[model samples]
Target: MLPSLAFLIVSCNLQPVSAAGTDVVSCVFPFVFDGRSYSSCTKDGAIDEQLWCGTTSNYDEDGQWKHCSLQEHGGSSGGQPCIFPFVYKNQTYYTCTEEENRGFWCATTRNYDRDHKWSYCADIRLDANPKGPCVFPFIYNQTSYSSCTTDGMSNKKPWCSLTNNYDIDLQWTYCEPSGGKRKRRCEGRWGPFDTPV
Candidate 1:
């Protein structure tokens, strides 16, 4: 009888560590993120889809495992760096790292003048390169345009028009100087008017 009692004591002491504590429910898919392991299966009668091992102190409560809230344990993809040459408002923009440290930002080529359109440069992970082209405004034929590609005056002709109202087609006619007096010969400049001749 004493030997049987000693054997029972040894058997109880030799129980598995997990058996001594709470039992974990089997999960089909498990994933780890942000130093936390999560299972894609929920506990019995649990409304939530995923279950976190850290939710419960013993990972089980009254034979029911705790489920993780979608709001609390949902994975986040925020805080990602930005990419360069992105188009905003129909214009291409590039990132500048030098100005990033100074609290400056990245903006589209057209938005370089506007202060509000710029976004945090560091968020886009821009690389510092002094030689990189920076957007600058240029005047051509009494019109203002912004460009980061050309260093100096571009060889391309400015989209000059006779009137301010112009479209993408840029359909306009060029007129030659009349030397202060209307030409006697009708050469495309004259319109229907009462003449004293």
Candidate 2:
């Protein structure tokens, strides 16, 4: 399985028809679906098992969508969504990364060098996955969250901390439901994560 990126065919020339007739063609990165923010395409709520993405930033609110590919994965499980072709450190990233000891992370924007926006993929495993350093069962509100939670933020996006105890470290990032870690800087005043476009 690929990490971060929602794999798409290299030559995709789809002409999706919209009822509203709005002229937005390109897919919106890190869009919202079912209240969870996504940085890539997903099949979570697909009609026929095809990977699809919202045309606008919020599918729940806008209901605009288009096909990504023709029913790839044969109905396999869906994971966190990530935007592809994102730039980081002068390099382009098409999949998730474990750089800097951060967990499976993906740039939340098209240019990480400018925005510095990113998030960790979400994993529901009982124990921390051996792949990276993201601490599982992190504490929030004195309650342990083995997976990402939307309760901590106003946007209701999924997020988790780097340490086993968010109460102490306070380092965390919004998480993708696709697989598993995007640690935001954990310190000082709490602020909202910038929207990924």
Candidate 3:
């Protein structure tokens, strides 16, 4: 009785399809299913094909075609929507959407490196102000600094630091000596430092 019950469980999990000839041609890597390309292939049977993520092919303990594990998205559960947040440099971004299997959505942010500032995600609805660059201010070793865009400047650079000590709401200022005393000589292309009027 136990053997019969086990056979029924196994049969219910197996998908039935019309079997073709034994010489079935396996699907190639990056298999396109429902218009999306999968990175890997699992089992290649006469009647059905199983494709997933990772390498182009899968191997079994006996060196045969097998199904590789599916890639798991962050915060995913029971077919529910997943919004995966990732931080780069210092800014936060999200990925994945309510729709299943759809690829990442694209958006602009200040979390870029020296090259680009755009990233792909599932959605960008959470972005309050996508048009403007994101600014991040931080303090280190009793000195405050800010990272902001230089769009309107003459250089048209993406990132530049405030010349003055950074504050949450205070105005920016140039780096000056403390106690109104001239320490080391200010030497740069801007010429010698002059006392503020």
Per residue, candidate 3 scores C-alpha lDDT tens digits across 1-197 of 12221242255453222121111122224443333444334232323344322122321111122233233222212222322222344443233222222333222432323323332231212221112112245432345445433332344423222233223322221222223433211111121222111
Sort every candidate by TM-score, greatest first: 2, 3, 1
Write model 2 residue lDDT over 137-177, tens digit each, in one string: 77877888876577657677666666678787666655544
Evaluate all candidate structures by whole-model CA lDDT and list the values in order: 0.28, 0.51, 0.28
- Lowest-scoring 10 consecutive residues by lDDT in candidate 1? 183-192
Writing each residue's lDDT as its tens digit, candidate 1 over 2-71 gives 2221242255442222320122221112333233333343332222322332222222221222232222
What is the C-alpha local distance difference test score of candidate 2?
A: 0.51
Off by over 4 Å in 1: 1-78, 85-93, 97-128, 131-133, 139-145, 148-197
Give the Å error, residue 83, model 3.
2.2
**Roughly what TM-score does model 3 have, to 2 decimal places?**
0.19
Clashing pairs in 3: 104-121, 105-121, 105-122, 164-173
* Best candidate, lDDT: 2
Off by more than 4 A, model 2: 1-133, 179-197
- RMSD in Å for candidate 3, one decimal? 20.3
TM-score of each: 0.19, 0.28, 0.19
